[model samples]
Target: MGIGNWELGIGNWELGIGNFFLVFLVFLVFLVFPIPPFPHTPYRGSS
Candidate 1:
């Protein structure tokens, strides 16, 4: 491996896997927030 393991494992590595988790969390939030075609549009129920 180069300096550390070339692949990521669940153990404590020199390059923190927390960074990976932080990015993944941000990505998940991004996916969840922008799904609606019109996010600001209010609900018009049962017309």
Candidate 2:
């Protein structure tokens, strides 16, 4: 059943204890130090 698989995916993603911390850690790292500044600041005096 298509609907059943969809539910399973959601359940696993939310309930499973594996990789949860890894995902959180990765997000924290990104939040702490972003690769590229969001919205991209324009160069000073360029315009």
lDDT agreement of model 2 with the native? 0.51
The residue-by-residue lDDT of candidate 2 on 1-47, one tens digit each, is 33344555568975433345555665576557765755342322243
**Alpha-carbon TM-score of each model against the true structure:** 0.39, 0.40
Which sections of candidate 1 miss by over 4 Å?
A: 1-14, 35-47
TM-score of 2: 0.40
* Weakest ten-residue segment in model 2 by summed lDDT: 38-47
Q: Which ranges in model 2 have alpha carbons more than 4 Å from their true place?
A: 1-15, 37-47
Query: Residue 41 of candidate 1: its Cα lDDT?
Result: 26
Candidate 1 residue lDDT tens string, 1-47: 22233255335555456556665675576456754665542222321
Give me the candidate number with maximum lDDT. Answer: 2
Cα lDDT of candidate 1 equals 0.48
lDDT of 2 at 13: 75
